[model samples]
Every structure is written in structure tokens, then in C-alpha cells.
Target chain A: MTDPREAGFVGRRSDGSLIRRPLSPHLQVYDMAQMTSALSIMHRITGVIWSAGTLLLVWWLMAAATGEAAFAAVQWFLGSFLGLLLLFGLTAAGWYHTLAGIRHLMWDAGRGFDLPSVYATGRAVLIGTAVLTVLTWVLLLLFWN
Target chain B: MADGKTVHEAALRTPLGRVRGLGSAKSGTHHWWMQRVTSLALLPLTLWFVISLIGLAGASYAETLAFIGAPVNAVLLLALIAATFHHMAAGLQVVVEDYVRGELRRKGLILLIQGGSALMALASAFAVLRIALAS
Candidate 1:
């Protein structure tokens, strides 16, 4: 065995070659060649967000069921700046998930498998999510106030 | 048991049967089917939810309760709760399976997600029911 001093921390083979350390491939190694892969991963990530986001919905429903005072407390929190930020994040996540989910359904029907169609649909999902989110906020601002 | 195969396996298998039976997990197809079905249902349900919530924004508690208490709204809300939570549980289960390494921890998390989703779903539905029927 080679002296540990020559190798320092890294292990060395008998012939002076550095031993290969096992490492998991990480983000730095991955070359995402197309948008579909990124969008596909985002779909799952946003799904997780959407599921957690439903907690707000549950909290709102529970509050409403309780009474006015309880509901008002919830309303106050939801009307706060941080709460609005959460709402906006949820809004974006919801729309993105919806659009990406539709793309998944289209794939289930055996369409959009070709590379061109995949990229096109990926772009559509991104555009559609933005459009829907913007439209929702515009309507909210225009009418809700 | 000739050739260690069931008679029905050779006689009744179709192309669809082959595909369904060919996967390593042999179980993902059902999960996929359920996800798709719930997602399709959620498409309209979620839209209804967003629009209704928009209408209810800044509304008084009484007005919001009244809106939910309407019979149609209550029914649709119930449907949305069922579909959405079921969908959420299924989706989260897949994520847990993919990332969680330790066997016990993975199973624990899967159970947690399922149990939590069920609890929340029940709570949400009860809230809707209480409003629609009681007040």
C-alpha cells in the first residue's frame, strides 16, 4: 500500500494513480438539451407545491366554518403582504401545473412524441401558464378592488 | 403447469395485455391512469374554484359563507375536495418513492402524506357541509 502521506486525503492506487471516488451525478453534470425535460421536472416540483398550497384552502374553509371572528382573523393574515406573496406564488404554481398537466394528457393520447412537437408543446405550456396567470391577476385587480 | 406457465397467459394475452404486463414495476400503469383521470376532473373543478374565489375576494364572511352554502357550490366543492386530495396523495407518493432512500423512512413518509391528505380532505369537506347545511 502506498504511504498515506503521498496521497494526502484522497486514496491512491499502488501504481500512483489516484483512486476514483464514487460520486453521484449532480446538477452540474446534467446537460438539459431541451425545454421539455425542464418543464417535465417543474411539473412534478410544482405539483408538490400545489399540494402543499392546498393547506391554505383548507385553512380558509375551516375558518369560514367556525364563525365571523375566526374567518376575519384568517382574512387579515391573507390580506397581509407576505400572504399576498404566497397567493401569487400559489397562483403561478397552479397555472403552471394545470398547463403542464394538459401537456401530459396529450402525451397520454399518443400525440406530441416527436422532438419538434415536444419542444413546441413545452413552449406552449410555458406561454400558456404566463398568460393565464397574468390574465387572472389583471382580472383580480380590475374587478376585485 | 406445463412450461411453468398458466394456460390463460398464453391463450388470452393481447398486445395491450403484453404492454400492461411488461413493465418492471408492473404497477405504475394504474397509478398513471388514476393521476390522469383526477387531473382531467380537476381541470374544470380548479377553474371553477379560481373563479369563485375571485368573486369572493374581499367579500364579507357572511357573503363568502353564503356563496359556499349554495347547493351547487357545495356539491362542486365536495367533488373538488375528493379529486384534488386523491390526486395530491398519488402525486406526492411518487415523489416520496423517487427521493426517499431509507425503506422505513420512505414508507413512513408515504403513510404520512396519505394520512394527512385524507385528514385535510375530510376537514375541508366537513367545513363545506357544515356551512351548506347548518348555516
Candidate 2:
């Protein structure tokens, strides 16, 4: 019933009792320390990662179009340790985002709403992301010319 | 503070009343719908592109260029590019709107993302076309 905008708001809270006002899901009360929360936040984080990584793709494409020397330079960097690490991270992020996207689509269709199914699908997305990432690297190593 | 049943009921705003002139351009439904549509479109396109890349893994620079220069691959590449930037812009707009509290900065970021996406899409398409036609 008390608001900070009101003059007696502080007086009401002086007793250190919880306020009797409607509250939204906020940082102090609703702690997001669960698997579902982790997966949900990871979706946004990975989306940002791979979305930025698209610039790297753009650079690679532009280099390829530029000339042999340009392409060679980009290729050399991509083959280096740092470049490989960056690629690995981007690959993982892209995989996670894609898998999470599938889950989102499934949810859009009114599927997987139960608690057990939600956890199961979240786990599935994580495992799928990891498997796809490793498979991508393995394929690259085995078949890269 | 007379915050009782009558006052609250009288004060409750309708959905449209709340939305109108409440800083919304009213195109959020389109943005949300497009996000889902783009996400759906990316599924097969990305898988196809990834498999294609794997197949190209054993190629030289010229061979890679030749693959991209092919009519079918070039067209598919163009579609992937368009869908990607489109999805990226829409997704980032949601992210920015969620976290960025400053109105000026949020608006600036939205503009930057949309504008940057357009430019990058154009550049990628041009590069792909140049490779495909120059071959």
C-alpha cells in the first residue's frame, strides 16, 4: 500500500516488515538458480554471441572475394590457436542458440509445458548443442583440406 | 491512499488504452511474428549450409570459390544471408529493448542494428554475386 512516491512510505517500512504491495518477479525475491533459468538466460547469451560472430563470417566472405593474399591471411588466422578457440566458442554458441530456438518453436505450438517435459527438453537442448559442436570440429579436422 | 475496489476498477485501463501513446509504435506483433518466422526458416537453411560446408571442407580456395560460384549454391547462400541478418536484427532488438534502460540509447541501438543489418546483408549478397558471376 506504500510507495516511495508517497510521503509516509519510509515510515511504513521502518518496522522492517515486508511491504504489503504487489510485486513483480524481481532480483531480490526471485532468484534464478535453477537449470531452467540457466538454459533460458543462456539462450539470450548465445544468441548475442553468434549474432556478433556473423561479422566474422562476413569478414571471411569479404576476404575470399578480395584476393588470394587476403584469403590466405584470413585462413592463416583461422588456423591459429586463438582463431580456432574463437571458432570453437562461436560454434558452441551457435549450436546452443539453434537448439534453444527449436525448443522455442515447440513451445510456440503449445508443446512441452509440463515441468518434467520442460526439464527434459532443456537437457536435450544442452546435450544436442554439445554433440553438434564436437561433431562439427571432428568433421572439420577429419575432412579439412 | 484510497486504493480500494471502486477506484482500482475505475482506473484499470484496457489493453488498447494502455498501449496507445505508451511509447509503443504498435508494430511489436509484427516484430514478434517475424522473429518466429525467421527462426523457422533458418532451421533447414542452416542445416543445409552446414552440410554443404562440411562437403566443402576438403577443397582448396579455388574449389571453395567454385562451389559458391555455382548457381544453386549461390542462390542458397543469398537466402541464408538474408534470413540470418533479418533474424539477427529482430533478435537483437528484443535483447536491447529488454536490457537497455536508457530510452535514447535503446532507440539508437535499435536503429544501429537495423541499419547495420541492412548494410551487411547488402555487402554479403554483393560479394556472393561477384563470386558467382565473375567465375
Show model 2 residue runs off by greater than 4 Å: A1-30, B1-24
Model 1 clashing residue pairs (backbone): none
Q: Per-residue lDDT of B1-135 in model 2, one digit per residue for the tens?
A: 333222223365677766673423555468778889989889989888887877876467898799889999999999899999999999888888765655688789999999999998988888899899999
Q: Highest lDDT among the candidates is held by which one?
A: 1
Q: Which stretches of candidate 1 lie over 4 Å from their true place?
A: A1-29, B1-28
- Relative to the true structure, how large is the alpha-carbon lDDT of every model? 0.84, 0.81
lDDT of 2 by residue, A1-145 (tens): 2233332222224654434432322234444788887788889889999888888778778877888888788878878999889989988998999999999999999999999999999999999999999999899888776
Interface RMSD values, listed in order for every candidate = 9.9, 5.2
- How well docked is model 2, in DockQ terms? 0.39
When only chain A is evaluated, what TM-score does every model earn?
0.77, 0.79
What value does the interface RMSD of model 2 take? 5.2
Across B1-135, the per-residue lDDT of candidate 1 in tens digits comes to 223222232565677867778554567478878888999999999999999888887898889999999999999999999999999999999888765656688789999999999999999999999999986
Please list, in the order the candidates appear, how each scores on TM-score for chain B only.
0.80, 0.81
